[model samples]
Target: MFRIETHAISLVRRGLMAALIVAASVLIGATVALAESHGFAGLEGGTFAMGSGKHYREEAPVRQVTLQPFSIQKTEVTNAEFAAFVEDTGYVTTAEKDLDQSDYPGLPPDLLKAGSMVFAQPKDPVALNDINLWWRYVPGAQWRHPRGPESSIEGLEDHPVVQVSIEDAKAYAAWAGGRLPTEAEWEYAARGGLDGAQFSWGEDYDPSEGWKANTWQGVFPSIDTAEDGHHGSAPVGSYASNGYGLYDMAGNVWEYVSDWWIPGHPTKDQTNPGGPSKTLAEQFANSAVGARHVVKGGSWLCAPSYCFRYRPSARQPAERSLGSNHIGFRIVRDGVN
Candidate 1:
């Protein structure tokens, strides 16, 4: 009788263990789904005017682009969300990894440390043509240590996580069961149903309307009036949402898009045109210093006199391997369950 009872108990324990495993799996699946869908705005995509002919040469030759339906996060990924991903996966970002010596032959040892480019505002107005006057490569500057090794994201949890490279953004998106949006998708969503507006909000851009987006309010790379109450990166959703209820689509940090960078858009209409697939070397005819991907929505460093690219049609090329303090990303989901 004792042996029989012991066997029964053992069987019961096995069954409980199996049941717990099943329950844990279900909970995990649910959690992943929640993470993917949370704070996402579904966009019913259609053909919209892409690029601007009036602004910079890169944005010239406006054309129509049709995109399939997709869902995008309401705001750029926040530091808290990225922190959770890092905590769960123990992932290390590109900026945190040591540089390959071979890539920087003969470079100074100190300059080869793990770090990222940060916007160091000059004390006095400097030449905007030379971005080097403001952008500095600081050692130990990663996403968590945004400003530098000494600076932390202590009070900036809600702010968009910066100093993340395209690869880093893709890893976080994969962990969350999503992917980076294409250039076409990002521009369409940034438009927020208003097809050809100058800014994300509308044609007229008057700060007296209470700063529609977080952009440089004073001299570029020098004096920031902080008229919008943000010296650098502002917390996500600090301003009003667009027509589709998406916030910070105009300014905050430049967002990464999947399409490779080309100088300008094709004039011909396109249906979800992902940029040219030729290798960066081939695309640039061997003139490019490095491979670059398109980053949209501009950043807080954008100013009227210097970088006035905080518009739906504005776009910029960022090196695929580099991460700057003014750059971050949002993710997108597609297809029905």
Candidate 2:
């Protein structure tokens, strides 16, 4: 009787384990599908309308951009989303890589120490021109620890991932069988179906009355009144989404575009103008002097007094090696799922 009972117990344990594995896989797939719910369903004329503003005309114009047709994550790849990827691939991010002091000229001994920078509500005012004011060089703010080593995403599974380097974004895309969106594709999708209008919705910069894209809520740098229900970043889809169902296209963390920093828009109608052949490793007369890469969308920190890239056409240059709290990226997969 004892021998028979032992064999039965073993069979029951194996069956339970098999059931748990099946349940876990199903739960994971559902989670991924839920995450991508906001991306473009299709490309067609719709409610959103963009106009050739100074920024648009300067960088992009009415041109033919033939996309191969790909599915991108509806919003930025959030902290929770990145954590999942890191846990699975055991991938170490660029910031996680140890930079040899010999590589960078002014890199301080502590600078080479492993960690990333994150934005914090400064107890005092910081000069926007002087980056050190707002960007805190916090140790342990990687994918797992966004705010700091002590911080966690316990309940914020949908907040856009920040402090991710281009290298980090690229690795996640590769692991997901996807890649980064080109500047053109990012613009097209962000436009949603809106024709030419000043902003994503229309000419005015109102977040109410059908223009719920992300923009400055209160005063630029000094004060964020949180008028539209967000002081920093609202939930992934807290505000209204563009026609393509993508949210936080305008104000949030600036997104990484595949193209390098190249002056001037396309002179001719083009199909995915593969960005600049080489990125300019020159000093930006405006921002920090370092490797230049293209960034789209204005972050929550943007205000009239400071950065005002609240339009889909607006673009900016970011240092490649630098990953700020206001910078992140989404992944794109060629062909629909």
Candidate 3:
């Protein structure tokens, strides 16, 4: 009968779809295995793999990939390194760029000066819903004065520099004879030999009773537990290294990457994808706002209670010109052959 024939066709379609799913899964597993063959940090302050079957990041998978290799700085760009870049290139960062009424919409007349967001005093607590409570509009909150005018990196030149914008990050990379890593490269490196990992270290948020990366230990905004031995950003290399000897690839500061987030990688076997040149705003008429750049390696402000983004593959984006105490960058240069 005609009805019987239609049922048969539907059954065939379902089987075919199932077959495709299996094939895709197999391909992804094989690709991940290849990466594993190269190296895995294993368990320590070292490896950060999440294991198979478990998803590390939501859309960003650790499955298969054939990518050209590159080197990343083991630690973030230290104040020492950034200071040198400034000396060599005399580059002015976005924080240094002047802003007017245009940059800050619906602002009061007194608040029109060019400034950047610097973390307010935790000693001074305020409501989470209130934006003005936690962030200070600092006149000099650039890579140099991090916490603003009263703050200085004088003795902490070894500390990873914060408040550097995407433009500033690019400038440093150019001067230092390197370039920024793409989102894939940044996450790959952040994993530090650990692939398909939920957190940079492993599946568990804490392990070995050993210290993890620098992050908010106690209540955010107020009362930091300081279990990681310091509050706010620590000196670079303060913690143990991952497989490739990278430090603070997790909580400390978010590093900027070369790629813009493209809803998701559209094809399999994508080689060194740099993300969509067009952004979410361009595609959607209602979305007047869009931040394309991918920020990896989550910052020290991350917490399990609020943001568990210390995981390597974690990402988000803000305007390139945006500055915050929790945002900073690392650099990548041509890797050694």
- What ordering of candidates by lDDT runs from best to worst? 1, 2, 3
Pairs that collide in candidate 2 are 39-74, 48-194, 49-194, 49-195, 50-195, 50-196, 50-197, 51-197, 78-161
Best prediction by lDDT: 1
Candidate closer to the true structure by lDDT (higher is better), 2 or 3:
2
Q: What's the residue-level lDDT of 44 in candidate 3?
A: 22
Flag regions of model 3 displaced more than 4 Å.
1-63, 100-111, 121-132, 262-269, 280-290, 335-337
Taking all chains together, the TM-score of candidate 3 against the true structure is 0.75
What would the per-residue lDDT of candidate 1 be over residues 1-337, giving only the tens digit for each residue? 0000111001100001111111123334434544454478888888999999888888888988899888988889887778777766767777776655676555677666777788888999887556667777788999878989999877776788898878889988998889999988998888888889998888889887688888888777788898988878998889999998889998889999998877788879999787877474246522323446788998888888878888988888776656788899999999522
Least accurate 10 contiguous residues by lDDT in model 1:
1-10
Candidate 2 residue 249 Cα shift, in angstroms, is 1.3
Model 2's TM-score against the true structure: 0.78
Clash pairs for candidate 1: none
Task: For each candidate in the order shown, give its overall lDDT on alpha carbons.
Answer: 0.77, 0.62, 0.60
- Which clashing pairs does model 3 show? 31-64, 48-200, 50-197
Best by TM-score: 1
